[model samples]
Target: MAGTYSVNTNLIAKLAELRITEKDIHACKLPAYEQSGNLVQAEDDMFGRTQLMTPATLTSWQNLKKAAQDEGITLLLVSAFRSIDYQCELIAAKLERGQKLSDILSVNAIPGFSEHHTGRALDINTPDCEPLSEAFEETPAFTWLEANASRYEFGLSFPRDNEFGISYEPWHWACRLLD
Candidate 1:
């Protein structure tokens, strides 16, 4: 071996990119996420795997799944709890790909401001529905969630033109403990 070489340009690049102006940071206005209860990895379902979530949320989710199954609606998981670091990396990749920060923010949440950070939010879909699309609202699973998820203390995070700048995500549900 000749000489060992070490480099960390990637880290440097990340830090440099994060050196955003006050206006830019203000424009982002990341969401505030709250955490409660112990987060545990969700039990695998028919659709796919899940990330870690609160045990209470998990129990409600399991119950929701059972009810959906009983009604012949097998809900699928598109996403669950995601760490802030992961969100940062995801946004960074999008930014690197020449996507506008506003455009990216319209869809994905900024690291510290994601509902997924609370281990309470989850994205769901059906095997027959398009993932993360409005079409999901037309699916039986969405309909089931709409009709019954409330019983499990789950509710949709967004509806078309609700308030937050983020786009409507019909598949995104959260189990917020009303305190």
Candidate 2:
């Protein structure tokens, strides 16, 4: 046989076009009702933890939850749908916690680039546990996700090989095109 041929660039180009667009993305902002009716009441959950999400995201979470339950794995929603100000506060707190500004920028997405800004993204936890870690990712929660998340229209937003600007976040998951 002659030399093997590589994949065609034209085919790759066609495939790329099918990918989701920025416009289809939705950022976590003040909820509609909160924006117009209860600005003062728009508060972050105690200690900056919250699990609010857009309808699309909630649906995805429901699916994920159901699948996890079917397999006897319990996954808890730790944080979701953060507002711009809430993000700012989080950044400031991290800064106060002795993290260098540059270091913060490296792993954490700037306000705009934050998938947390998109109501579709979530940071999950186990019962009474804190922020997620590799230990958790290798546990029942992550295993359950690996087995069923795609079926529920959720995907690991940042993996080791992610092209996204952010670092790999084992706990973060994004819902199908936040459109």
Q: Pick the candidate with the highest TM-score.
A: 1
The 0-to-1 C-alpha lDDT of every candidate, in the order given, reads 0.72, 0.58
TM-score of 2: 0.65
Off by over 4 Å in 2: 1-50, 94-99, 127-130, 177-179
Q: Write the per-residue lDDT of candidate 1 for residues 1-179, one digit (tens) a residue.
A: 11111213443344346443334434543345544346788866445565778888888888998889988888877778887667778888888999987677677754555788788888887887778889998888887888889999999988788656567789899987532
lDDT of 2 by residue, 48-143 (tens): 643567776776777778778877888777677766456556666787788875666565543434666557777776654556565667677887
- Provide backbone clash counts, one per model: 1, 1
Q: Compute each candidate's TM-score over C-alphas.
A: 0.79, 0.65
Q: Model 1 off-target regions past 4 Å? A: 1-30, 35-37, 44-50
**58 Cα displacement, candidate 2 (Å):** 0.7
Q: How far is candidate 1 from the true structure (C-alpha RMSD, Å)?
A: 9.5
